[model samples]
Target: MPEQVKLRDGTDTWVLALEPSDRERLVAGFEELSDESRRQRFLAPVSRLSEAMLDHLIDDVDGVDHVALVLFAEGPPHVYDPVAIARIVRYPDLPDAADLAVTVKDDWHGRGVASALLPVVIRRRPEGVTRILTEVASDNPASLAMLRRLGPTKISNTTPGVWDIEVDLTAHDLPQPIPLAVVPPEELDGKRLHPVLDAPGRHALRTRDLICPWLN
Candidate 1:
């Protein structure tokens, strides 16, 4: 069964592991991303996801070392709108870590979509994967901030406009697994807001420490 997560705005999103059958929805979701969103995600101009890419993303995925999770909004009769996607693919040479990537629909931005999806991806990570790595454009502050909340992170400027981030999942000190599914938004009341939701519009770049280490 798909897990249901409630967003801060009180809307519900169903989270499920992506399967071969979800190719069409996934393509549609990619098509809906705004141009800027596409650039931020793929780090290049992508007009659309090609057929070969779709086939590889769905059919070629092994679901063990390579896992993909997608979030969908409940829609009218027999339909679901894909709103966000997160994936962790084990590094070919790095045994203890995997590469992480996440993207949320433009309209759904700042609604805590990525925040809800991230933990689910982590919890479902393949066994023995203790670290997560990601590359984000230096201009994309929101993503950097979201990652910092996970744990002690190592950030470095690998290229002029790109940064490499490594997060040690085992070092995260969260007291418990975050609840991704539950009814009644009130049930989440009084609970601490996820870092993504707590400080909207803030960027890690604004805080010098996040990027300064590389300069020293």
Candidate 2:
């Protein structure tokens, strides 16, 4: 069943598990983000998501190591369009932790699209994952503030322009975590989001950082 939500602005939306068939919708959603939004989300001036990048994003969302939710708004009558997606990719070596990121279409900004997704995402996170990890660009204070609201968080500057954040998922007011169907990575297969490998003291790798897979 799809989860329905009413935004703070009195708009109705539905939240559902993102599936492989939603590739076109996912692509469309990325096209809707502003340059600054892409910068804050991917930590780079990503003008386009190449085919390889899209494959990395959609191919491994197994509801375990990679769990994701898409939020959609009603269009004409029964039609629904994706407005945002929130996802976590579990660390291959560190099963109890997952890297997190949320992307909302630029038009839906300040409308509580994310607020509606976070709790459901939390309640349904992969088993043994008690922590959520992410790196927010230092310049994006909005994301920084949102990270603070998740739970007890440990945050620090891993690089000159990025803030590494880890939020205690168990500390949040959500139901206990459950064991999800595990999907073993054939190898250590995740995109490195931050350009720097020398992020001294960084807790987790950017698991979905294939923003520029070809360059890597």
Candidate 3:
């Protein structure tokens, strides 16, 4: 099932777990990415996703060791068109952390698509996942900005124009308790729910027992 998410612009988008049947949409979305976007995401200047890579992505949706989610519009004609994807894959040798990656369609850049989708992925963090790590090209300021919104990040420039960032999920304040139901419009008032990206913000709500602190 798809869940409705509210963007900072007050528009609605649907977030769903990627499935094998979504191969066509996923491919189409990746094909639309620009050269720079592709490089920032895959760390390579590739024009197309290989068959093996596509298969690995679609087949790793167990929602445990591998968690992936895609954001898309629900309107007709483009309902299945993926606007962005966020995924976290655990390392067998490094049990306490996972590598994270997020990519938004070029047309949807700067629209908070990644901001909205990231919280969804973080809420679904699997057991034993203490930290999330990602590698970003130094030139990719947009990707870096998105990661900064989560919290204070530990960044290392191991190589020229490449940075590795690590974020400790438990470093933030504990979330305030809220009902695990659809948030009503009245509750959406400024005082009712705090912005998820605000440092030290405590407002949060639950869905299916998963607490999403940054949904608002």
Q: What's each prediction's clash count?
A: 0, 0, 1
> Candidate 1, TM-score vs. the true structure?
0.74
Off by over 4 Å in 1: 74-80, 172-216
lDDT of 3 by residue, 133-194 (tens): 65677787766666666655556655466666666777676333232133354432333111
> Once model 2 is optimally superposed onto the true structure by TM-score, how far is the C-alpha of residue 149 displaced, in angstroms?
1.9
Best by TM-score: 2
Per-residue lDDT tens digits for candidate 1, residues 151-213, read 766666545666666777887474332322322444323332222212442221111111000
Clashing pairs in 2: none
Lowest summed lDDT across 10 adjacent residues in model 1 is found at 207-216
Query: Model 3 lDDT vs. the true structure?
Result: 0.61
Model 1 has an lDDT value of 0.64
Report lDDT (CA) for all predictions: 0.64, 0.65, 0.61
